[model samples]
Target chain A: MNPLKLVVVTAGLTQPSSTRLLSDRLGEAVTRQLADEGRGVDVHVIELRELAVDIANNFVTGFPSPALNAELEAVTAADALIAVTPIFTASYSGLFKSFFDVVDNTALTGKPVLIAATGGTPRHSLALEHALRPMFAYLRAVVVPTAVYAAAEDWGAADAEGLSGRIARAAGELAELMAGRPATSHATDEVIPFEQQLAALRAQQ
Target chain B: MQFGIFTVGDVTTDPTNGTTPTEYERIKAMVRIALKAEEVGLDVFATGEHHNPPFVPSSPTTMLGYIAARTERLILSTSTTLITTNDPVKIAEDFAMLQHLADGRVDVMMGRGNTGPVYPWFGQDIRQGIPLAIENYALLHELWRKDVVDWKGRFRTPLQGFTSTPRPLDGVPPFVWHGSIRSPEIAEQAAYYGDGFFANNIFWPKEHYMRLIGLYRERYAHYGHGTPEQAIVGLGGQVFMRKNSQDAVREFRPYFDNAPVYGHGPSLEDFTEQTPLTVGSPQQVIDKTLTFREYFGDYQRQLFLMDHAGLPLKTVLEQLDILGEEVVPVLRKEFAKNRPAEVPDAPTHESLLANKPDEVPVEAR
Candidate 1:
């Protein structure tokens, strides 16, 4: 079996964004789980704050910038994606959302996505289910069943053990999703039309 | 150990030169500041969203998605995602698309937004802001969790067996933080859903944010998500640093007085005294910020408003250097020392998703 490729996307631009920290932890957990499963996996992490120009330009022009083009390529090629954002109001941030507006509609077709968010309190945790999940659903991406939300209190202290366990569980689910390969019956289906099948069979006889 | 800087972008004139940086230049400077934050060892970067003049981050996700490709470790987030104004459906799809682009280092702070007229611009009413926030969020949650949703609400049109696409990365949605400066209703909303509550402690005194955070903590426990102490909280701050305390004050004073946000309203000294804006050496910033725990109790994330006040980009970069080298390290150590063993660190994507309850099967409504 081919190793799964996981990519983590973060919308935190500051040095201490909770979203990014959470995303990195998720990446680490996924990597560890894959390793434990004896399946080699390649992980890619992309931070959206560094690509400000491409994002801004793309929005104005209604087209993908060259830099965004590369990012789109990465998404299309990846096996799964982990996306994290901070909840703003009752939804995802404009910076986090605008990055996706430029991608080709088909880029995320059938891709698996893990959604997560960080907020100051637990109230906005639902933004994942309400705002983020539907967005990906429209894009035709296969979002993971579980969504992780870390309230501000989640990081109030320095307990790596608790945080790591949560990450590992999310990663474990991702591993399971990746491990269950979809059947590829279309490829094996006989190409001959129904009418042609009889003729082909007769000819073979 | 995540760290980064955020720019509340403004197109301000260089007071000395009488020349204003274009919106483009100012926006680019924000990116440079983010890079500098990362270069200096901070972990994440965020920008605010304002649709009006003097504010350049009208489209934050676009900016963050662009930044995603350039840096490796820096997480990109928004100081505000206008949940009150923007359509919830668009919000869901856009961030999910960004999730694919940036990999997974994305999260957002949801706010009702400060601007009044922006509501009409987006075909919404300011009077309906709270209800909009509640209703739209409810629908958004369903869209992310259920593969197909049938939702009918007062604000937006109903959804009949609709499915939002580009399934969230790994089938999990991005984390959410509800940011409120003075609205208890917003805090209540956050607590009701067990989300993070952010008090951007920039303008008001500690007492104001304290009440808000206190309410959130109390209600979080009421909802049975966790203990009040386990309620997630994030705070916002502002600082100006120099090697010498006196120099920091001297350099920052002129900019503070003339800044568009609070200019001519209060003396720079008075404003700093009243608000979380700290002006002095790195030690002063560290000391003032550490005291936040004293007022708000143990908290999860801390963000600084470094790039506001019309400060030049060069000066802002210098601030990041001080923050990375002198300020954050000390605070990190101090925060860790005081943290209790039973307390949990703030949630990240990993920690939040680790413990899973069985999925609730949905029936068509």
Candidate 2:
């Protein structure tokens, strides 16, 4: 059996960001869960902060830089997605949202995604549901129900019981959803053959 | 291969001087640029059509008609004439009129204009862009090929026994090239009609255009338009040059940094590395241009964008002189060597009339 390809997108702005920490933890948990099920996994991480300039440039120029294009292909070709972002002003950071904005709207349709976020306090926790979930839903991705939110306190004292448990449970859910699914073919980059395109236009006519 | 220049006809402030030319001066600058193209040995001069400000070439035929009067040999074309918003009947009549004025030195590239609001400005919905391009071009194709077109389509009022006036010159409709940055449907349409496919090779990386041109060639063959090598292909490029490569970069960096389309995005170096944009000596321009053939196979036309980003009119005219004198002559000779004997040149009115005389409409004859 082919190793399940997993892509983790971390949109934390600062170096040594807690959002990336949460992402690594989530990635490890998912790998552990899949390993427990006797499955091998291939994982890729995308640090969107490093690509912020490229993303902004894509907006202005209408095409991604080659580096960003590779990252976008990795995201689109994954069997499952683990997207984590730092919450800013009650939602995912603009950089996080902007990265997805550059992705083809239909590329994520039917993709299995596990959404997570980090914030300073637990009050912004529901941003995962109100903001990230609906955005993925709009893209028609199958968002895993158990979204992990790691507030700063959750990384220290509050992490004792509930945080680890949530991480395990969410990881398990994603592993179950992704198991036995073939790696996506990066179809977004494939040219739709001319005959089919013509037929489609002709059908509409 | 044919070498020419295409302009967005932007009214930009010269970043170096911080002075903007008035619209009248800018328009005259464009005319002067066209005259310079003819004076130089360039093969074609194409103007882009934009319905908004910051861009001035909204009336392509009107501009080309004026250009037609001045130039004798230069083939006047469009970077793109919007196939989505404008009425097909008007396009047929206007272009036929242009053909007459320019002595059949006319061809057009069809594009769905990129500006979103221009759709509603012409009473069109942006969502229907592709369908409008497909349906509108279908009607326009017939309006020119068939003297009396009886047509009905989704976007426009039906036409019954309507004949577009001033039929195409020499009983042959002007050649059409579909100019698209990314649309596969437009590529298919170009292949379906055995017309040309022009890749706007300036803004994006050549790898992206390689895929587009490769698909176009494959589909052109699939549609029985001869072998893929025989399919008509054109590419757009942008260059800035001087005697020394560093001087070229030093002079172009300000304009590249402040230009409207690609400014504030990628650095000048990265943009040059990532796209067909070359900022170097004449030799560097020639070397970079030759590599395009290695990627897209032998092509028919090559048009460069030299006048945008408010590189003062003097600078533009100098660039043209460099292009005509130094770059294109080398390219023309280099591209011709090792090129397949069977590959045809870009179609001219004379070639079209000679090659497919039977296809000309009866009334046109």
Candidate 3:
């Protein structure tokens, strides 16, 4: 059986960012959960800070650079996504939203996404619902029900209410969602046949 | 293979100095550019149509008609005529008249104009752009082929027993090439009619165009036009060349750094590597252009964008001289070297008329 492909997008600005730490923990937990279900997984991590200029350039040029293109293909080809971003101004970081903005809107249709965020305080937790979730909803991605948010203090706690518990719950849900799906091929790159496009246009009219 | 130049007719301030040409000088310069294209041995010159400011070629046929009277052997064509907004009836009449004036040296590429407001300015809704293109071109196709037509569609009023005047020269409709940057439906439309499919290959990456052109080819074969290799394909390229490669880059950098439409986006070096814009010596331009045939198969026409981004008129004319004298002659021979015999040459009025001998008018036949 082929391995399920997972893409983890981290929008933490710093090198040793807690947001990426949360992303890595969630990714490892998801991998373990999927493995326990006898499903193998291939994980690809995208560090958005490194691609900041590329994303801005893509906005202006209407096309991605080659490196950005490969990253976009990875996100589209994944059976599931674990998106982690540092919360800023009660929302996902601007870098996080901008990266996804460059992604083709239709690329994420029906994709299973696990939403997570890291912030200085718990007040920003609802941002996962108000901001990121709605954005994914607009893209038609099937977001996992459990969203994990880690405040600065949650990283040090050791109880059920801590970041680890939420990470485990979200990872388990994402793994459950991914385990039932087949490995996705990059078939979205294929152009629809002209007859089909014409039929679609005719049907719309 | 046919080699030519196409212009968007932008009225930009020359980047070196802050001086902008008056609209009159700009229009005259466009005419001078077309005449120079013929004098330098280029095969064709195509002008873009725009209804808004900063663009001057709103009436392509009028300008082409004027060029038709001045130039002798140059094929006058449009980079694209808006099929989504303008009445197809007008398109049929204008190009047919231009064909007569140019003595069968006219063709038009159909496109959904890029500007959104132009749709409403022309009494069209921007939301119906594709439908308008599909329906309008369908009527335009009929208007040229059938002298008297009865047609009804959603976008336009029904036409009954209407004759488009000045029927195509010698009873042959000017060849059509559907220019699309990304839309596969447009490619299919071109294939459906066995017309040419042209990729606006300048602004975007070649891979994007490769898929569109590849699909056009496969469907062109599916429609039984010919083998996929035999499909008529045209590609747009842009180049700035000098005798010295570094000098080429240095000379074009100011214009490239601030020109409209992708200027200030990517560095010239990066843009050159990513897109088809070549800033190098004439040999470099030839080498980069020859790779296009490899990417899109053997194409029919190659049109370079030589005159945008506020390059001075003198510089544009000089570039044309190098293109006609240095780059194209080599490209022409190289492109022809191992081209498959089955691939048809770019269709002209004469070639189209020759293929339809039975349809010729009574006297012409």
Candidate 4:
């Protein structure tokens, strides 16, 4: 059996960022769950901060640099995606949204995703549902019911256990979905046959 | 085995001298470039189509027709004729007239124009670009081969018993080449019709176009047009040449730095490294161009973009002189070596006419 490929994307600007810490926890929980189920897992982490200029240049030139191309290929071909970003101005950071904007709109269709975010306060935590989850839904990804958001206060000793429990629940839900679906390798050569395309257009006419 | 120049017809300010050409000067410059292409030993001269400010070639047929009246052997063509927005009826009539005027030395590249706002200005939605390309080209295809056209499609007004005047020269419509930078659907369209596919190879890495060209080749064979190697392919190259590589780089760095498409984004060095843009000695340009045969198998046409990015008319002419003199001769000789016997040359009016089967007109049908 082919091993499952999981790509974790995090938009953490600084080293030792709590957003990255949240991503690590989520990734570990998913790996642990899948390993316990006797499945091999391949996890690749994408740090969006490193690709800030490439992302911006892609916007300018209408094409991605080779470095950004690799990241795009990895995300599109993975069996599942773990996307985490820090909330900025009541939504995902500009860098995070720009990355997805450059991705083919149909690439994420029917994909399995677990959405997560980190914010300075719990009041801003709902940005995960109102912002990130909806964006994934627009891409037609099958997002899990449990979205894990970690506020800065939630990283304190008082809420550490709470965060971990939420991470475990979301990870378990994601793993269940990944294990159910066969490992995916999106075929780059797949194309709609010209006859079918013409027939469809004729029907519309 | 055709080498030529394609200009975007932009009126940009020269970065080094801070001088901009008037629209009239730029229009005349494009014509001069076309004439120069023939004077120097080149095959084709293709002009772009643009309707917005900063771009002057909104009327390609008029310019090409004028160039036809001047030149003797050069092929007059469009870098791309818009398939999405322009009425295909107009395209059929215009190019057929150009074919007669140019004595069958005409070909066209069909593309869905990329500017989003230009779509709405022409009463089209950019969102429906692919479908519009499909339906309109289908109509254009039938109008040329058949004497009468009865057409109804989503994007245009219905036509009944329309006869586009001036039937194609010798009843062979101009050869069509589908040009695309990224879309795979365009590749499929080209393959389905057994038309040539032109990859804008200057913009992105090779892998992106590799997959697209591979798919086009596969489907070209699947549709029974020919083997993968026999499918016609064309590529776009951007080069600036001098006797010394350092001087070439020094002269072009400012223009490359401020180019409207990719300037101010990446350094000139990185852009050249990642994409097909080459600013170097004649030998460097020749060596890099030969690698294209390795990448895309055996292509038929190679058109370099040497006139854009605000390079002056004098510099562009000098660059073309070096290219036609030093670079292309070696590329032609080297690319011909070890090449398979099965690959076809770029399609010309005479070849297409010879290959066309005997058929009677409306009286017999």
Strongest candidate by TM-score = 3
Model 1 residue B318 lDDT score:
81
Model 1: per-residue lDDT, tens digit, B1-365? 34556667888876655678888889899888877877887776878889898789898888888888787777777788888888888888888777778877777778888788999999899997876776677667677678898877666777888888877776677777899887887787788778889898887667778988998888788878889888888888889999998998888877877776665455567567667889998888989999998898888888888887667888888888889999998888898885876667766555546754645566633
Sliding window of 10 residues with minimal summed lDDT for model 1 chain B: B356-365
lDDT of each: 0.78, 0.91, 0.91, 0.92
Sort every candidate by DockQ, greatest first.
4, 2, 3, 1
> Could you give the interface RMSD of candidate 1 in angstroms?
25.3
Q: Model 2: how far is B333 from its true place, Å?
A: 0.5
How do the residues B1-365 of candidate 4 rate in per-residue lDDT, one tens digit apiece? 99999989999999998999999999999999999999989999999999998999999999999999999999988888999989999999999999999999999999998999999998899999999999999999999999888888888889999999999999999999999988889999999999999998988878778888998999899999999999999999999888989999999999988999889898788888888888899998998899988889999999999888899999999988998889888988998998899999999999999999988676987
Top of the candidates by DockQ: 4
How far residue A83's Cα lies from its native spot in candidate 2, in Å, is 1.4
lDDT of 1 at B336: 86
Per-residue alpha-carbon lDDT of model 1 for A90-122, expressed as tens digits? Answer: 899888898877766777878778899988888
Candidate 1 vs candidate 4: which has greater DockQ?
Answer: 4
- The DockQ score of candidate 1 comes to 0.01
Interface DockQ per candidate: 0.01, 0.49, 0.47, 0.57
What tens-digit string does per-residue lDDT give for candidate 2 at A81-155? Answer: 999999999998999999999998987888889999999999999999999999999999999989999888887
The order by descending lDDT is: 4, 3, 2, 1
Which residue runs of candidate 2 sit more than 4 Å off their true CA positions?
A158-160, A186-205, B358-365
Please give, for residues B1-365, the per-residue lDDT of candidate 3 as tens digits: 89999999999999889989988999999999999999999999999999999999999999999999999899999989999999999999999999999999999999998899899999999998887888788789999989899877777778999999989998899999999987888998899888999999988899999999988898889989989998999999999999999999999999998978887677888889999999999999999999998889999999999998899999999999999999999999999999878889999888887888574567885
lDDT of 2 by residue, B11-100 (tens): 999999899999899999999999999999998999999989988888989999999998899999998999999998999999999999
Candidate 3 residue runs with Cα over 4 Å from true position: A186-205, B359-365
